[model samples]
Target: MFAENKLTDDMAEIEAFLVRERAKVLSEAEWKFRMRGYGYNLRRTNGGVEVARLPQNTVLGTLAL
Candidate 1:
């Protein structure tokens, strides 16, 4: 049916959007890890992937104290 097809198309579009957003997050994480000595981790959850930044030992890190 037309409604079913429309639903499928909508699902595909949503999936594509999530993929793009995930890619962007990964790219930014990679850049930060490489250029700024930042640490990161990607974990899978019931909802979706979670991008987390690990603590880094930096001058600025201590300044926050």
Candidate 2:
């Protein structure tokens, strides 16, 4: 576990974060690239937040290709 190894604290800050992030218009090509790379679909919600939904059955890992 991360805590056992003291790798990170319970309230550690994330590497890339959004502090009051505003949504920017993304073109079709840009959107597709984002989806393929991270499996996330982004859309503007009524609440003014860029909602990103992850695809199902998608698992993330680090392995050599």
How high is the CA lDDT of each candidate model?
0.35, 0.31
How far residue 62's Cα lies from its native spot in candidate 1, in Å, is 42
Error of 2 at 47 (Å): 0.7
**Candidate 1 vs. truth: CA RMSD?**
15.9
Q: Per-residue lDDT tens digits of candidate 2, residues 1-65?
A: 12222333222221122111112325645643544444333344454324233555222221111
Cα lDDT for residue 54, candidate 2 = 51
True-structure lDDT of candidate 1: 0.35
Instruction: Report the lDDT tens digits of candidate 1 across residue range 1-65.
Output: 01222432243443443344446555745533442332324344565444343453211111000
TM-score of 2: 0.29
**What is the Cα-based lDDT of residue 27 in candidate 2?**
60
Worst 10 residues of 1 by lDDT: 56-65
Model 2, residue 30: what's the lDDT? Answer: 62
Report lDDT (Cα) of residue 43, candidate 1: 43
